[model samples]
Target: MTPEGTGRALVVGGGYAGLVTARVLADRFDEVTVLEQDHVTAAPEHRRGTPQSRHPHALLARGADLLEGLFPGLRAELREAGAPVSDFGQFPMLYPAGWSPRVRTGLALQTFSRPLLEAAIRRRVLAHPRVRLLDRTRAERVVLNDARDRVIGVRTTGDALRPADLVVVTTGRNSRLPAGLSTAGLPAPDVLRVDGKLSYTSRVYRRDTASPPDWQASLQATLAPTARRGGTVVALEDDRWLVCLFGADGQSAPTDPAGFAAYADSLANPHIKDVVTRAEPLGSIYRYGGLGGQWRRYDRIRPWPGGLAVLGDALCVLNPLYGHGMTVAVQQAVLLARELDAHGPADACARFQRRSARTLLLPWYLSTSLDLGWRPEGASVQALLARRYLARLLRRIPDDPELYRRFLAVQHMTASPLTLLVPSARGPSARARRGGERS
Candidate 1:
């Protein structure tokens, strides 16, 4: 098939990553088509395409900023829809040591269910004049040129072909891109995986606005080696609270009502349990497992084809426990946009792939290091040392507000992790030294 200049772009999934990609491609391509297998709906409801959507999700400070920049007034629209936007620093947290101090740190976190956020982005992206959504259509494999040096388009189910100048795959964690590449006579990217055997059981509860909790959201993080249980209670739209209880290693949360409540009560902190005990259940408990980190080293592939790029979970899937998946996906989308704008479609795919791999390094390290702690066999020397340092830092956070603030900044991706290496101004020794110097 012959192609026009800067012609069509195909996105082989309509999830969050795919939507963002379609939006970005719309700016450069004459036509952008998103082929999704699920029958997407207008309402903020869960679909079969994303089973994890039923669980609680967090949009980190960095992700919120990027999404707002991409879709102006998105935060306001979510706020109007009753999604709570609050300073992330003020959210109460129970760490390995004790309760984290609630202080303002200028970091904003917008809380909502995954489905709601996806629906919001989907509406905005599909509304673009250049973007089109082809729901209930599955992209069987990417069509390649005879030379196998370039991707020509995608072959959908029923042997139908959709021609495009570029084909971006965002099929997510369970992507079939590897198989598709193999079928197209190309080498599949090597997979790197670290499984922590993490599991989540979540349920929504009716929030009583008249007697609101002191904190809008709360977290009790799991500390490996001793504590395998953790949970979170975040305020969501329509006066609802999404409570998710999780366990690491061999532990798994029960889906039964009584068992779920018992799991929450077993946590080291009482915050989530207290809320779960009193709140009225709004829905059935949903459970998700097989959670861990996986990375497809697409950048390392030799003879990488032009006009093909993998973004988001298709390239790397970080354990959701750290809440880095959405943020990293947004970062990848931003990187893709920059590459296309700088180099144009003809030569941007390979460069974008390599850069995207570099972008995943930090988040992959942060996620796997903690997960490795759950399985001693998989823990390398570097992972062990990181866990030790993180444990010490968590122990100090409760007593040092400045330290907690800095940690919060790092968690939100607003500050560098190196900042944590500095001594806290509020630490007792630091204060004493400062006093002596002043005297």
Candidate 2:
């Protein structure tokens, strides 16, 4: 298990984080093996591997930049392949702010389905000489050293335990790390869960008519019962629009054309409904429920295991509507690469978890804060106040374009949420500053 001289590193997933970490590892380590349960194919179609692949997804500005840095020319290739590359105003947009005014705000967004992005990343990963892709392999246990604490390899569910210098579990949202560890008779890691009883049904539409005006490149409409619904008409390489609609359980979206349209018309804004009526049907509506929040606290453990680490949704998962899952996963992977390189000659697993825990702070807060807005029975006074305050700001977005841009930037993960409160365009007014108090 010596890593001093080009040791093997086993990465236990091929999702966004796993793939990036594999590529980064190949550059420094002698060998990098990525074991995935499903075969990695180039098709843009969704498969059993990722149920949510059919849903709408985007590469935020920060994530996009990171990918571009790792795999240069990736953007040009996607754009040439038919993926839309442009600013917020180019696509139809909507918000509680009304149909967002069609104005150039300089904020850029990369639109595509999840599978398309995965395909691109997979290609890059497979191209690396030191990287190998192993499909249909299921991880069973971590190979422990004489100390019974330091992991040295991974044994597949039905396969033999093989030695390695490192093992990263990137199993994603349905991660079994805790159960897996407990089954192996190890101490369980700390865990966190936050549920926002929200739900939705999604259907794809091949837009035939011109897009709606002031159409947000995407839309998250305010809905009845204080619920919300959102969708994005992304331009896939095949020239089809992947439309997704989400809502709280009581006001959940439906798959049937009639029911779906009715729900769209019910939105605070009308642009999404307008597009729904005219867009050509591409496929049947795909529905998924049980929307919630989660986080695994590995760093808090007093004695973290050696030779083992976690990444991707296995470590932290955010609400899908926020679209920060992939972005945060990418950021964490980037940090993994940085930490591993610095501590390559020493014990790095514990350090990796600490840094990863720190990185998840901002995204975890954003997702948890937003999810608390709607509840199954009733919301608390704090939730009500927070909702009212946010709603007021959202309602004012139409009149204040600067505020709109700032909101988009923060939502896109290009800027920190705190940036909006500081002294800047559309920030707290001088009056509030002079008062020496909160806004």
Please provide TM-scores, in order, for all candidate models, with all chains considered together.
Answer: 0.94, 0.87
What is the alpha-carbon RMSD of candidate 1 to the true structure? 4.8
lDDT of 2 at 359: 72
In candidate 1 the C-alpha lDDT for residue 429 amounts to: 32
Task: Give stretches of model 1 more than 4 Å off.
Answer: 1-5, 428-439
Q: Candidate 1 — worst ten consecutive residues by lDDT sum?
A: 430-439
lDDT tens per residue, model 1, 220-286: 8887777788989899999999999988886888999999999998876566887789889998999
Q: Residue 360 lDDT in model 2?
A: 78
Q: Which stretches of candidate 2 lie above 4 Å from their native place? A: 1-5, 89-93, 209-216, 222-225, 376-392, 423-439
The Cα local distance difference test for each model comes to: 0.85, 0.70
The number of clashing residue pairs in model 2 is 6
Backbone clashes in model 1, listed as residue pairs: none
Question: Which candidate has the highest TM-score of all?
Answer: 1
Worst 10 residues of 2 by lDDT: 430-439
